[model samples]
Target chain A: MKLTTIAFDADDTLWHNERFFTLTQDRFADLLSAYTERDHLDERLLSAEKRNIGHYGYGIKGFVLSMVETAIEVTEEKVPAHVIREILDMGRDMLRHPIELLPHARDAVVAMAKSHHRVVLVTKGDLLDQERKLSESSLRDHFDAVEIVSEKTPDIYRRIFAEHGDGSERSMMVGNSMKSDVLPAIEAGAWGVHVPFDLAWALEHAEAPEGHDRFRVLDNLGQLAELVGEIG
Target chain B: MKLTTIAFDADDTLWHNERFFTLTQDRFADLLSAYTERDHLDERLLSAEKRNIGHYGYGIKGFVLSMVETAIEVTEEKVPAHVIREILDMGRDMLRHPIELLPHARDAVVAMAKSHHRVVLVTKGDLLDQERKLSESSLRDHFDAVEIVSEKTPDIYRRIFAEHGDGSERSMMVGNSMKSDVLPAIEAGAWGVHVPFDLAWALEHAEAPEGHDRFRVLDNLGQLAELVGEIG
Candidate 1:
């Protein structure tokens, strides 16, 4: 019953975030199909990220600016203002989206809350997008606090655990991403549980090295609740 | 016109290899859809690779055996003999495949052979599978020598260039995979050209950092011949 603090990731974790990014990207590709190549578009987006990382920050809105920049650069002076408007509107749709929690996300968070565990939501992205999502989800009440981080380094996890938890073996991290979530937590002397989700990138899905026993993989979030409950 | 040695990679560079593995995997997933999960299948295939790397070396044949081993383990000896046959058949097809050269692969190699280039086929895989592919391709005449390596390390490129081209800038490496083919060659002070192909694994597609002067990216082998001819 020692597991006290539970940390969760936000994007593609509590709600549908990446699917929107994927969909927007597909549409952007479709828009640029006549004028530019996917690789070129990707490079332009990368460039825009480099340019705006200090100003616009990161997430869908930053991606939106990059797409606009790419379109303008590729189309030269021939860029129709209407096309720019369309892309901006697309960005707006992303911002205004209703938070659709993944299956068992709400139930698990609610269960953890009722059990009086110190639940925290740790996520990386544009501050406004993360804030908008939390406000929309209405499940933010379940978490004791939320941390919108710039990156998910091991240091960040250690800092969070130290500030929020018993700073011992009672802290655990749950996430769908092995790289960003489980591995870093394990490195920070916290237990990690991995719940693999569909649409995980190939780089993110690499196998855990043999005999890495501090981590566990779950099929569903329900199983996570059961594990926490069992330990509690 | 100092380009002396030309090296080519096997697998997708010369012929079809990974697609067959992918097809077999999809079919295997279909067969085990009822009993085993896709993620479980993925985990076991990865596990088998880790387990057998010391024993079987690396390549398509090793991957096939891993698949077979995974099937048996997952099904608990209840898998039918026919199903096992199907898995074995997929492996055999890979081994028995006539090394069908990519478009302009043979013509470009022939052109280089007729020119002053010391054509070398440098590939990584199970030694037997790579040898079989070379023999089946009828490309034996095109290459003065062939190197069947276990892994494509930067050291491998350096050693090959030094041994084959007397450690001169007159050596060049050409292949479809960027991580293995181009970067290592560039890093080893040899000319490198990337011939991008469809369906490259994410691991094989690492980006070139900005401002790489010694590297070139070509759309096809035809372009590669022209670029080499121009450089020479």
Candidate 2:
């Protein structure tokens, strides 16, 4: 397959993301320790996130909102105003957190930029948060295009590929999430290259497509350029 | 003076948006009536919105967050958890709110769709919220493309017009906000048409361009098609 386009997922794929969420989640647990156990709070928060995803979509803001909702619910609507304020502060801190690029992220993007292939960042989250992260990441110039979507569906991958590159057949998507960045892209008739980040969010987990010819996995992003060359 | 592209802004430009915010603000004031005066609450909420715009960007979510922050601030952290829950519920209600298309919104879009020019929906707000509104509006099929941005600026307009249409010189942007939808668009070397909505957000208020050659204003969307035709 001639891969004329290489799309990368942001968040955990290019930079440290899920860890920040984990850190915030831990902080959330601490803030509510008096109201409920950590595990219960996590389950409720996750459930709230699942329920609210359709409404709020994905982002730090949604996560924080879910935490607040979960806090209110667990405390039986007795969650202190200061706890809510602290939760909001955590979200602000997350939004303002400096971008920390993962190893070889810049190199991989730079390689794709130098190559003939179109380099696009296909991420799903709050438009402003994604735009802010990308702007802060100092790697925006390496991309030919940026698509901050609400979700990564098969149809979305198909449309993005068709719009930014030759098509799905000539495109490859690289990222961390099996459910979001990999499987849907593979289903869209493109190469789905998984570069596993150490910490994965439970919502993003999925059974790996082991036997699919178009599916591939790498230990890290360092080998991405070589893999692209091999595929070409 | 060839107008090959006609771009329209979403939110109050094509639908009843500011009224909902006003309604939500009213509810918020009632919830905190014990703690602060209505005018004082409004002022605090506006200040919070302005300060938090950089972090939260724009949308019902941010607005709700700002309201929550204002509630906490106004009450000096004495606000009850039920009030916060009510505020969260208000945000959900706003997100789930049905689209109310403004006068002649459909006809104007249909008119532009039938014309030779490419029609594009250029909006700035929460991605999912805007998408939901567009989908619910049933006017999605009329436009050639949709651009939901974090903010609207001259550079953004130029890039959008160039990517989706011919370029800024051959494009015209129609919307409600003088700050967001008109002035920057005109600055980008495109025709900026203002369709004044009855209730305008204070943040979006701007002095109307009195005599700019490429600027025009209308009473409603009903006159948009005729205005475009006259310009051409």
Candidate 3:
């Protein structure tokens, strides 16, 4: 009954955000098919991630911009104007598409809201893209607080807990990532429930921490309610 | 001909290495089909890579051991003894396989030898594995010196140049990796010819150093002799 606050990650947690970008990138690959191959386009994207890390940080917007820049550079000024417009159109689609909630995300958030727990949506991305997602999800009203951050680290979660809770162990984080969400919350001295996504990028698949006590990886979010109920 | 020294990498460079490990991993995936899925097994390997960094250093031997240990843990004591042997046998195959040179590895080494260049094989691995590779390569005769090192750093190339050459721009490096082979050599004021491999692991990809002119990334090593011939 001491559980006071619950934090959730945005991308791949409540909705299918990355799949949109992935589809957009596959289209970008098709756009460059005349000039280069899919693997080559992937290479440029990988390089762009490394290049734009400082400028744009990380997210769909940065990725979209990088793809545009790469298309021009790869074609050596021979890229047609129609193709350029198509690339921009892809970005527009990524933004305009409605947020698609995961299997149990909306239901879980609603259930938690009916309880007394303070729910927070903690996500890191471009301000506009993340805010647009919140507005579209319609579950934004369920959260008591929303944190749009540049990076997810232990300090950020600790700050949230320190300000929001009475330094209690009842605070918990539920997310699809071990690297960004689960580990940081655990390091901040809160419980972490990991909902493992079926597919992840190579960079996101690091090892779990030393012990099993602080972390729990689940196949489905439907199992989360039972875990929370048991914790109390 | 100004070229005097040539160096190389050990894993995925001299023989068919990583592909064997990948195959064995696929076999491990088959064995764990009942307990865990392929992606989960791969996730465990990624975790082991991060975990073993402090303990195992890096190489095929350590990776094999980690794979075996993960298989056992994931199977939860239900793993059969035969599966363990198959994994060990696969590792042994990689350890014992003949140094089947890449398309032009031997030709380039032989061509370099024709001009009286002091060929030095600079590889990083467990000491025994490196020595075993050199002995089996029949390449021991080609190399004037062989360094079985723990890593390839800027200091490594600096020491090699200082000890071997007359501190001239006459030394050059040829390898499949841009991270360990090309970048460090360029940093140490030596020319590097990079032959991009099909499966360049994330661990071995380096960004080009700023304002460095002594690096060239070729599609393959066959062009190495010609590239060096032009540079010299």
Residues A1-232 of candidate 1: C-alpha lDDT, one tens digit per residue: 3888999888777788778877887788787788888988767766766764543334664566566666767765345544555665577677677889899998988888888889999886655467678878898888987876656778889888877778636888888888888888888888788877777633345566346756888887878778886666
Query: Which residues of candidate 1, in runs, are more than 4 Å off?
Result: A1-232, B37-40, B43-47, B50-55, B72-82, B202-205
The alpha-carbon lDDT assigned to residue B65 of candidate 2 equals: 89
**Residue-wise lDDT of candidate 3 within A13-103, one digit each (tens)?**
8888778877887888888899998888788777866775544455554565566557766776456545654665576577678889899
Give the TM-score comparing model 2 with the true structure, all chains together.
Answer: 0.99
DockQ score for model 1, please?
0.01
Off by over 4 Å in 3: B1-232
Which scores higher on lDDT, 1 or 2? 2
lDDT of 2: 0.92
Which docking category, incorrect, acceptable, medium or high, applies to candidate 3?
A: incorrect
Chain A alone, TM-score per model: 0.86, 0.98, 0.92
Each model's TM-score, in the order given?
0.47, 0.99, 0.48
Q: What are the fnat scores of the candidates, in the order listed?
A: 0.00, 0.76, 0.00
True contacts kept of 2: 0.76
lDDT of 2 by residue, B86-145 (tens): 999999999999999998999999999998789999987789999999999999999999
* TM-score top scorer: 2
* lDDT for B133 (candidate 2): 96
Fnat of candidate 1, please? 0.00
Clashes of each: 1, 0, 1
